[model samples]
Target: MSIPRDTRATVTEFLDRLAAGDPDRVAELFAEPVDWQLSWPDEGHPAIPWIRPRSTRAEVADHFRALAEHHVPERNATTVSAIVVEGGNAVLLGRIGQTARATGRSYTAMFALHLTVENGLITRYHIYEDSLSVAAALTAAPTG
Candidate 1:
């Protein structure tokens, strides 16, 4: 007999698939009408054009594409400091490191991610990261 998976399991599975970086594969995980937002300061960096409020699964996928195009990520593994999940809600605490394409300067920042999974699709996603550090890295001179 096969049992249905819970929200937490569904989320983990979806994230695991996304880790492969197949945009088409990940897009299948979102509900048609999804609410997504990558929260940051009002003065958003144009250099990182992928960060924005989105209301559809396509936009969510576009956000991923944007990051892939704008940042040259280092080989270092992303560190997940913490993860909290309850029912359909989850919060991820992690840090990421990447080099901004425009400035070619390294940027590292901690982030808190909020995710909501229902049935088996992502319904809500709100991620918060340090925007000031990103902007500075994009604007400041490269370190010698």
Candidate 2:
């Protein structure tokens, strides 16, 4: 479905601010009591120390902080490949490029994000990415 101009603009700004790596500004685009989910299994959580489901806006900022602590993000500017809007929800197609801080190994993968935006504020965020690829990079964090 075609994305509305307003919603597209909102998501674009959200993505832009996210890529800028300012957690506080990124959190501002989210609604209070934000719902955040990472598409990783329970058993796989330990390997990826930074990724976990978050329920609050403060938790969301912490999540990004944790990510920065573990990985040096190379995708300072992430490209939004596609945007699909359904009602108040939008799916964003993109990728993240990063280097594991401990191992200095590059980890890059395509990603899909499901976002629920109401009144231009994101209320729900569910991200799906290749776990095996992500975990591999995460594993080397400790050894390297």
Candidate 3:
């Protein structure tokens, strides 16, 4: 199925809101009871277990909030490189740069966000990023 123009617009608008640091606008793009998953490449363990999936908008919001609180004093800055929409799905390739308030560390990492839209709202999303780099930035030794 091909993506509808309106759906594409919605996806673009959502990304714009995210890049603009407007959480409320971002929330408006999500369908009620949204499912969000954040996955990282695990180098350890036999199964290489990834972080548990998060379902529900509130849970997703809390996850993002925690990440923001850990990384940025106010909010993390997101930069989008490209967006591809097909059917009810959209793929966003981007980079995120932030300075951790607690550790005063800086980090920049690439990310890919896959989203599923239903009724002009995002119902499901999966975020992939360089977890190790992000962790290091958020927990590294402070620089003078």
Candidate 4:
């Protein structure tokens, strides 16, 4: 599929910011009021507190911060295997590995993220990931 240069650049920047693990920088690439969506159930909210809904850029930063607070920094990992961009929309296929600090349990999950970039800012952020594995890692007892 032919992808727009500008769209690809924006997506690249987003990925770069994410890889840097800087929430503020990541949030800066997003629009003021972003449409954030995640694949999480209502009952699982407490188990993974960072997996919450967000709209504003500040909230976006806060979301990352919350995730950082709950997960071990050294154990956090993200690998983007593929990215497809068309116009201002992009989809990222990747795997994420993280260890829950509270329970000392780890989980790895595949994730598909859809982002809509308009005027150089991401407006829509929707992510579908293996929530069950993440919840299990966060809430389950440590195996070791």
Question: Which sections of candidate 3 miss by over 4 Å?
Answer: 1-5, 41-52, 73-77
Question: How does candidate 4 fare on TM-score?
Answer: 0.90
* Collision count for each candidate, in order: 0, 0, 0, 0
Per-residue lDDT tens digits for candidate 3, residues 39-144, read 6543332211224455555555555555555666455566789988888888989998888776778778899999988877788888888877667765667777
The TM-score that candidate 3 achieves is 0.75
* Model 1 alpha-carbon drift over 4 Å, by segment: 1-5, 41-43, 74-76, 141-144
Per-residue lDDT of candidate 1, residues 1-144 (tens digit): 121257777667666755676665666777778877777655556766776666776777787777766666554345678779898888989987777776678778888988888777788888888877777877777556
Worst 10 residues of 3 by lDDT: 41-50
Quote the positional error of residue 19 for candidate 1 in Å.
2.4
lDDT of 4 by residue, 49-115 (tens): 7777789989999988888888899987778999998888999999999999989998899999999
Q: TM-score for each prediction?
A: 0.83, 0.83, 0.75, 0.90
Using lDDT, give the best candidate's number. Answer: 4
Q: What is the alpha-carbon lDDT for the whole of candidate 2?
A: 0.76
Cα displacement (angstroms), candidate 3, residue 56, comes to 2.1
Model 1 clash tally, residue pairs: 0
User: At residue 4, what lDDT does model 1 achieve?
Assistant: 23
lDDT (C-alpha, whole model) for all candidates: 0.72, 0.76, 0.69, 0.85
